[model samples]
Target: MYSKKVVIRYTATNVDQPIICQLVKKHDLDFNILKAQILPRREGVIVVELSGSKENFDKGIRFLKEKGLTVEPVSKNVSQNNDKCVHCGACTAFCPTDALYLERQSMKVLFDAEKCNGCELCVLACPPRAMEVNIF
Candidate 1:
């Protein structure tokens, strides 16, 4: 199974959220609303985390696009070589979802992409620049 994080930007008064939510729920997918900010211009930006099978993920993205909602993909940076990681806790500390953690014995940091909120805090906090976020 695969998961995806989606960021949605739209007007606050838009009633289309329920439609999107219904479609996602129909697929038995799980989602979280991370950030919601009402801008001075009366628009809003809503960040959401979605987890499910690849089929559901693709369907959800397509559904949002068909509804004319702006959708962006967000996830942890895994492109960096693991050997380059210093196992520093800086990135873990900034993870909004506690997705990064170090093993008590090996001291090796593990990343849980499913738990990640795709906030990009870990990427910015990494001193080694190991964490990467691909926004689409």
Candidate 2:
């Protein structure tokens, strides 16, 4: 199966729509919602991992764009800047996938890029701004 992680932005007009459901039902796609913060009549965002046939995946993404939603890949890479990281463990607290964690013995922070879902929570929580997202 083809799979990719994506970030979808919703404006107030489409915030209440069952867009993800449509992706599944109409485009034969499967998705895992990694993170979401949506409210009625307001801008919202969702990070999701979608999997399906390549053609179906393309159709599903096109459908989202047709609905006036902004869709983009989560990131090409998510990395930690060791030069800037203090290893305070702040980013670890916000990492739902355990991609960032504290190494108790060394008192250092470690990042595992494979486990990250690209939700961007670590980027927001890191006080030192060590966690970085490279979209390209």
Best by lDDT: 2
Q: How high is the CA lDDT of each candidate model?
A: 0.70, 0.86
Single out the weakest 10-residue window by summed lDDT for candidate 1: 72-81
Candidate 1 local distance difference test against the native: 0.70
lDDT of 1 by residue, 22-130 (tens): 7677776788776666565455666677788888888877877777677876653333348768998887777777788888899888788767666677777889887
Candidate 2 lDDT trough over 10 residues, lowest sum: 127-136
TM-score for each prediction? Answer: 0.52, 0.63
In model 2, the runs with Cα more than 4 Å from the true position are: 76-129, 133-136
